[model samples]
Target: MVAGAPYPHELLPQLVEIFSEMSVCIGYNTSLDLGFLDRIGVPTEHLTVIDVMQRFVDYLNANGGTHRRASLSTCTKYFDYKWEGTAHNSLADAKATLYCYNMMKVIK
Candidate 1:
């Protein structure tokens, strides 16, 4: 794990390699999740992707919710918070994902 805000690539590959062995990959609504990993040279072909956004979006649709936005900024506004640090940095992104998941639960 990284100790500070920005994560170095050297510290990340091992963790990704381990998790990539799994048959399934899951993330909220972010295609950027796997996309980012792929850009960094991780093989994503072995993994089956599932977007949790669909599940949550379906929930909202069923409940007649009119909010059509799910981007990070919109999500932050609706949920009443934003992530604490660097945007594109992987470690910060990970924390944002956790915070976003919690926020989604609250708003939904």
Candidate 2:
């Protein structure tokens, strides 16, 4: 969580509003995150979700790398991204996911 950020449940209305304006949501394990958002009353029905983990695995398979599953850490390491923050921190993890996605796009 960021400094002075509201808790998920407390920010439901703002989250819904923000998500509604977005064309798509991209994240690692996006289904899980969307599910949690849905459970917390955030509306995500209109959003298309792009999961970086799935994209990474598909990229690997298509490029002759034999990876069955791709975690955030694995993808970041494969792309040689250095981690500067604690693992599992949401903001850091999100940054890593975006970096991995951009790398995949470059490779494609």
Candidate 3:
């Protein structure tokens, strides 16, 4: 393990394999999620990625102002997401992202 590495390189190939099998990967913030995956040795280039945060940035900036970063909680609440778990928890955030995505789909 390199200094401060979160996980060892073991399972990296499996992670890449999983991503290779994905048709689309949706993330609330691709810059963070995908970048973290890349930093952790996951090959992200092959996966078609969607950044929901960017998609909703216009709405987030609806007041004719520049886009400011919005937290997952804020986005979820805006979509009326009924959060089932604690905020800042990974699984909960993922669910919230999915809910927000579905809401966006409905709006479109």
Tens-place lDDT digits, model 2, residues 2-102: 79977888888888889889988999988888999889988888888888998998888988988877788888999999876866997789788888889
| TM-score of every candidate | 0.50, 0.84, 0.82
Ranking by TM-score: 2, 3, 1
Runs of candidate 3 exceeding 4 Å displacement: 1-8, 62-65
Worst 10-residue lDDT window, candidate 2: 82-91
- Using lDDT, give the best candidate's number: 2
Cα lDDT, model 1, residue 36: 83
Q: Give per-model CA RMSD.
A: 5.6, 2.6, 3.7
TM-score of 2: 0.84
Model 2 pairs in collision: none
Q: Model-by-model lDDT, in order?
A: 0.64, 0.87, 0.80
Residue pairs with backbone overlap in model 3: none
